[model samples]
Structures are given as C-alpha cells and as structure tokens.
Target chain A: MTTLATRRQAAPGGSTTSRPARSGASSVGRPGFAWALPATIFFALFALVPLAAVAVLSFTSWSGLGDPEFVGFENWETLIADPVMLKSLWLSLLFIVLGVVTQTPLSILLGVWAAGNQRNRAILSAIYFIPLLLSSAAISVLWRALLDPNFGIPGQLSWLFGDGNLLGTQSGAIGVLIFVGMWQFTPFHTLIYQGAAKGIPTVLYQAAAIDGAGTMRQFFAITLPQLRNTAITSIILMVVGGLTTFETVLILTNGGPGTDTTITAFYMYQEAFQSFDFGVGSAIALVLVVVATLISLVVVKVSGYDKMNSSLEGL
Target chain B: MKTRPNYAAGIGSFVWLLIVAIPLYVMISGTFQTREEFGDNGPLSFPSSFTLQNYADAITSGFGRYFLNTVVVTVGVVAIVLLLVPPLSYAIVRSRSRGASFVFRFFLLGLAIPAQAVIVPVFYLINAVGLYDNLLGIILPTAAFALPICTLILSGTMRDITGELYEAMAMDGASPARAFFRLVLPLSKGGISTIAVFSALQAWNGFLFPLILTQSESTRVVTLGLFNFQTQYGINIPGLLAAVTLSMVPVLLVYLFARRALVQGLMGAGGK
Candidate 1:
C-alpha cells in the first residue's frame, strides 16, 4: 500500500504542465506562430541572447573594448578565490539574513493585527505602505538626511543622549543600512501576509476561538500556518530583492569605507562598468546567475513556490 | 475572530508607527529649517521659524524640467506597455498551441535573469542602436522588461476568460480582432489597470536603467535628476528633500487612490 501510494504520487502527471517547454518538444497545430513570432524573437534576441552571451563571455578574456580570447575556468577560479568577491558574498548573505530576521516576524505580527479590522487596520496598512509607495532612491536620500552626522536625526539623538553616533562607525552604519532596507521591505511582506490572512475564511478563527483558544493560540494555530505558503514565497522574493539591491547600497555607502559593506553585485559594478573590466564583470554576472538559479531551485523545491505560482498562473 | 477591538493590539501598532514616523517627520521638518537649526534641533521640535527657502531653491534648480521629463517618460512607457502587453497576452492565451506555452515560458525566464546583470551589454546594445543618452533609450528597455511580468499578470487574467465569450462574439463575424477589441479589452479592465499602476510605478521611479543609459539635462529622469541636487562639496539636503517630496507626490497620490488595485496586483502576482 505504501509503495502504491509512492507511485501514485510520483505519477507522470507531475511534469505534464511544465514539460511542454522543459522537454523542448515541438508539436503541430502550434497556434499561430506568426502571431507570437515577433515577441518571442525579440525577447530571445534581447533577453536570452544577452544572457547566453554573458555566460559565454564568462569563459573568455575580453578587454571590454577590443577583441576577446577564450580562457577556460580562469574567471571561475578567480571568483572562487577573490577576496573582494568572497567578502561581497558574505555581505550579501548578511544583508539578506538581517532583512528576513528583522522584517518577517514584525510584518507577520502587524499583518495579523491589521487584518479584518475596519478603521485602524486600513489606516495602518496605508501608513506602513507609505514607505513601499515611495521610490527607493527617494528613501535612500531621505534616510541619508536622517543619518548625516552633522545634520541628521541620529546625530541629534546621540547628542541629546550622549551615545556617540549612528552613521560613521561601522556597526552604526551597517545597522542603519539594514534598518532602511528592512523598513522599505517590511510593508511589502505585511501586504502579502495580509492578503493571505484575509483569504482565510473568518469562520476558521471563530471556530477556533469557540474552542477556548487564546489570542496567541489562535494566531499560532490559524494565521501562521495559513500564511506559511505566502511566507515562503515572500522570503524567497525578499532574498531576490536583497540580492538585486544596487541603488540602495550604492547611495547609502557606495559600498563604503574601503569596500567593508561591498556586495558581489556592487563589486561587479566596480569591476566591469566602473573600471571597464568587461570580462571580469561578465564572470561575476555568470556567478550571480548560478547563485540566483541555485537559490531559485532550492526555494522552488522546498516551498513549491513555482508550483504555487504556476497554479496561480493557471487560474 | 469576533473579539472587540483590542486596545492592547492598537497600542502595539501605534508603537511601530512611532518608529517609522520619526524619520519621516524629521525629514520633512528638517527641510523647513536652516542648516543651523537642522543640525542642532531635535527631530520633533516644531520649526522655530517656518522657512520655504529650500523649497524655493529646489524649484528653481530645474524641478520643473525634471518633473515634466518624468511625466513624459512615464506616460510614454505606460502607454506602450498597455498597448503591447494586452495584445501579446491575448495572442498567447488565444494560440491554444504548444507555441503559446513556449513563448510564455520565454517571458517567465526574464524574471529570473536579474536585469542588473544585463546592464553592461544592454548599454552597449543601446549605444549600438543609437539610443544612448536619450529618453527613448531608457523608455525602450524599461518597456521590454515591463513586458514580462505585465505579460505574466495579464496572461493569467486572460487565460481565465472563457473561450465561449469569444465564440459567442465570433458567430456574428466579430473577428478575432474585433473580439479582442470589444470583449477582451472591456472585460480585463481590472487586470489592465493593475498593469498600468505597476508599470507607472516602475517607470516613475526607475533609476538604474535611466542613470546608465541616458545622459544630460535633456533626458535625465527624476530619480537621476536628484543627483544633480547633490554636489561633491555636500548634498543640497533641503533642495534634495523638496525634490524627493515633489517626485513622490504623483505616484503617492495614485497609490492612495488605487491601493486596492496595487495591493491586489501584488497579491495576484504571488497568487499566480
């Protein structure tokens, strides 16, 4: 019976929706090819071709200005050993972890509190969402004012409290940067969880409450589990959003105080576009692709987000 | 589920608000003070003397031009994405073949490949195509990337549209074109507005693409225009703050009015 259950769950139907393109199958009655031809070829040439070219360029040595020469594994080996690249990898991880730790729980609590309430909750959602509504560039600028040692809020606070300051020092700097990133992102997660929590039938809570469940028990029993799928997807999206961060860190510190807070993407910026090391930049881009793809695969498998998304898409 | 409004829960939220509101209040208030007052005054202190001088400086420093340019670029991009995405999504859903699915996956891949990584090559391509340092340069690529997710959302909305609607219309010789025009466009208003809001936000706030691809006062976007507000000496803090406030207003207004659609749009993306 167990073996039968395993086989039944392992049914060929699992890949049916995905396999059409996954297997590279081309079939007849293929709709109007002429209809989609322009868009497909445009995306292929512009999007796919560049990505593929960057992948190929990862293996070669190009002056970024002149010709190219094939060099096998050189960029990969350099990437693996490069101190700056490794530091960036660490910083990126630190940033993402900090974001998840600080924002996720807070947003979850707020989202739960905010859901299904008429007056205060809607106002609070609107208020929290204000940050998300503003441009990051604007936020970075706004916070930079608040962080300025000579003229910012923290400086005034420190002077008022005699605690030194919050921007020039390394820990203070990293803290503020993380806080800003968290502040901007927490609302997004809150927004998602609120949607997820609201979609749960109100009767589930009423049903649970009637069974003598306290508020905390009701939260743990109903909201968290119901929001788990959204939590997973938002966490993954947060990681992606964190990894893609450029303007925030760029404006905040320009990677700062001798690359102390530098990230791989930022490092790639300095190496390739800033310094015109195109080959090296391409190599880093390929590394990002690999790392991003790995995280994507792991997240998809673990959370089944793609499956969830596909199902959502199929709706 | 049915408890009275918890005063305790309400307080919990107000504390969080206090944390977020401090910086926002301070920033806006700081803009009202002179450099001396800003440097020394507590963030919560009422302005000793209200000053609009900084806002004046910001307005004079080409806020008008930047605002107009942003409007033009955002409007152009929004118009194009709306025009292109609906028809393209309709084709994909209407195709009913393996090709539609293939093309569908093709657009999905764009989401995975970080647009940042493509900047260098995209720069070269844009320059090669002679769009460099121009408004059209940024508009083109922004529209391209916007296509993917917009297409994704619209396609999801499109596929759910029953074939019978098309069939019923088709009996009157409402050709595929006419069906899309009369039926699909009308029915998909929610999805299309969602697409518009999403694209408008992206285009309005878009920085990296415009920063790299466009140059000079002629085409600089609001996000990049704020850079000119800064100097090697020190940032024009008040001017920049006013600039930030100005740039944020339009989109903030939109979000305020259509937040349901905006949040609903994001949830729909995740749900899909």
Candidate 2:
C-alpha cells in the first residue's frame, strides 16, 4: 500500500490525492493526510475515546459525579446474577430472532414479486415504501394510538382481532414490536433484493424458459441461487438492525407491560440515566457490544461478505 | 413486457401497502380531530369536523421549542458531516497508503460500536467538556456516529469516478483542492447529496444522543421532547398525535422530494 501511494505520487498524470503531484513540490506540503485530519480527530474524540472510556468505566464503580472505584469484574458478576439483565438479554435475542424469521423471507418474496417494476408494481411499491419514509418515533406514536384499547384501530377491528390489546399484554406487546419492525423495514430489504434481482441477467431466466422450465422452476433454479449473496447481505442488515433497534420499542412501550419489551439497550438506558448506575450500565453496554460483534462476525464469515461483490460477475 | 396484470403479485403488494398505510392515515387523521371526536368516534373514523386546535395545542405546548432545537442540531450536524466527509472520503479513496487504510478501518469500527455502549462515557464526557445541556453536545456525537456510513458511501462513490477525470485535472495544473472543488465536487453530487440527506435524517430522528447528552428543556430535540410531551399530555391523544404529525412534516417533505436519491443511496450503502 505504501509503494502504491509513492508510485501514484510519481505518476504526474493522476491527481487523486488532495496534494497535487507537481514537480519540485515539497513532501511536507502533501495535503491528503492533513485533509483527513478533521474527520479523524472528530472520530477519535467522539467514537474511539468514548469507546475506551466505556470499556474502562465498565470495570469501575463510578457515578457521573465522583471518582471511580476500580471494582474489577464485580459489575459483570452483578450482571450475571441479575434476573432482569438476563431476561432483557434473552428478550433482545428473541426480538432479533423474530425479526430475522419474519422479515427475511417476506422481504425476499416481496422483492421477487415486485422485481419487474411494472406500472402497477410501481404504484404498490410507492404505497409500501410509505412506512420507510416516516420516523420510527412517529410510527411508534401512531402505533401507540392504534393499539389503544378503546378507540384505536385494533379496538375498532376487535371483531376480527378478538379484543386483544397490544402494549398491554406481555406476549402481545412483543409480537407487535416485532410486527412493527418488520412493517417499517421490510420495504428496505425488499428494495435491496429488488435491486439485486434486477442485476441478474434476464438471459439466464429466458434460456431456462426456452428449455421448458416453468416460472417456479426458473425461480428456484435461477433466481434463488442468484439471490443468495443479497440474501446474506439482507440478513446481516436485518439482524444488526433488529438487535440494535430500540427507538420504536422505547417510544411505543418504553419496555413496559412489565418489562416484556425491554431489550438490553433499553435496560442500559434505564440503568444509567433513570437509575443512575453508570457502572452497571457501562457493563451492559460492553456486553451488548461484545455479543453484537460476535454475532455480526459470524454472520459475515458465514455469508462470505468478502466474496459477495465478486459473485455478481455472473450477472 | 406486456402490461398484463399479475393478479397474485398485485394483490400481495396491495395488502402490504395497506398494512403500511393504515397507521399513517390513522395518525394524520387522528391529528385533525378533537379529543371528544377521537374518543367518541374511534380513531379509525373519519373526522366529522376538521380542527387546527390540536396543532395549536401542540405548538403552544413545547413541541414548537423542541422542533426548533431539532432543526438547529440537525442542520449543524448535517453541515459538519457534509463539509468533513467529502474531503475525508476523497482523501481515503485517493491516497492508497497503509495509514489511509488504517484511518478508513478506524472509521468503520464506529459502525460496530453501538451508541448504547458509549453512552455512559459520552454522557460523562459531555459533562466533563462543559458541553452538557448544550446542543453541541448532541451535535458532536451524532455527527461522529454518522461519519462511518457516510464516509463509506462517499468513498465508494468517489472511487467510482474514472481515473481519467483526475488525470485531466492534473494536466490542467490544478491543485488537489482545486480539482476537488472544480472536478470532484461537481461530479460527486449524487454521493454528496446522498450522505447529506442520510446525515440529516439521522440527526432529525436521533433519540439517544439528545436524550442522554442534553438535560435542559432548551437543549431538547423533538424525539425526546415528544416522549416527554406524550407522558405529560397523555390524555390529550389528539394533541400528541398532532405534534407527531407536525414533526413528520420536515422529514416527510424531504423524503417526498428526495425519495429517488434516498432509496438509491440506502440500497447502495446496504448492498456493499
């Protein structure tokens, strides 16, 4: 990489670097490194420093106002013994599972069905895309009203839904949380899959058709195979989104109906801000980060993320 | 390519659309009704009388203040992101050095670290820096969190610019900054616009930063304010929904106009 940079510097025709490669130009005047400094500094001050602080803070018994006591794994021990933490962690995982199970297949189906971008499909796609346009807070607010027992949509449609209220029951609230997530994001995955589907050369499917394969066969044989990489990408996105999602759940139920909807992030917020237990909060935060990183790394390795772009060569 | 109706797909699409649309209708329509109408007629019912009273109530009751705070933070964050990301992404994509790659990787690491993980320290950090209760507290961290993805998208877009364009600018004796403004900036409009809208949306909708970093009513952004507003005015559902609808306007308008770019950008970002 260093050689590439020096060689590129020697190539007088290329001016990609922020510093022009002019004859007799001083090496100290290269602006490429300087140009990137602001973003790097901003990132260091905010992301890197805060990350390290959190890691360090997790090991200490510190409130926001005083000197931290180096407790050393006591927070982690407390976390293990805490039932609420365990429950919140389990619920967070369940929410992610529910999201992946429901959203991935549904998005692929929707993507395949809408891939052609027909006129009517375009109109329907616009309608389907509406949810993606709104803020999660707005959606949570809207759903909160709609889930109201007396006057909202679910209540109005009680004849069909059996008078059950969402936000009030443990199981129902979790279900609705997952449902809302799928509702808001399925369009996103569908759009990604649609773009991927379009990238597949039509000739493959057409040739299959000429060989007397029906639409179903052509789909399984041609479309599904081609969609594999995109499907993996979609799963990575879906899982990460599902696991990290807290805003809608936060606003919709605030992890209420007795903490049924409280994911780890929500629990962390409650601990740190509401309860002012920064040590436990920081520990939860580290745990969440570690778990999320492990899960995402596994997903990436399984999906062959490095090979995804290259595999599109067949298209 | 005949315009033949595929009834199954059409019906499926329509069903999904309805699932997505009904709540939106409920929210907007619910905002237009009086609390009496809302309670009496059920939220799904069309309003018998359209009223601006809810809007009046929302604006009068702290929603307006929160809206302005949100606008300030969103504008500040977006402006910083756009100014910094373009040049940084340009540098990363242009300079093929080990140091540049390390910087790029460092930025990407931000994506994995959830804001929740850093919120503990971030809260204290803001307090330590004396930015607690300041909008800058929210702006700095929010912009920082937004950098990784924005840089990723911008660098991807920048790398796609043909090498010939850079060569031509070099031959013209244009300095790198001059070429960036004269050649790269003009050519990277799509990517720039994408990240601009992306960053703006993030800042507008961000809940965690404003919730954690800022404490005073003066520093509150809309999302946090909306939560508090709902709790305080829990009984006045219409007024709450009205505030919700009002907050949706700015972003809704942005989405309507930039739907194409937004969709392309999101897909492009995710596809990578």
- Best-fitting candidate, scored by TM-score: 2
Clashing pairs in 1: A309-B272
For residues B81-113, what per-residue lDDT tens digits would candidate 2 score against the true structure?
Answer: 998999898788776456777888787777787
Query: What lDDT tens digits, residue by residue, belong to model 1 across residues A1-315?
Result: 354345346657775755565223222212355666665665665577778878777788776565567899887888888898999898888888888888889888888777766886787777887777678888887777666665666556675635535655566667878888988888878877777788888898889988999887888898888887778878878788888788777777888867887888888888877877777888888778778878877977887666675544642
| TM-score, per-candidate, Cα-based | 0.89, 0.91
Name the TM-score of candidate 2.
Answer: 0.91
Query: What is the lDDT, from 0 to 100, of the residue B177 in candidate 1?
Result: 69
Model 2: CAPRI class: medium
Classified by CAPRI criteria, candidate 1 counts as: acceptable
True contacts kept of each: 0.39, 0.59
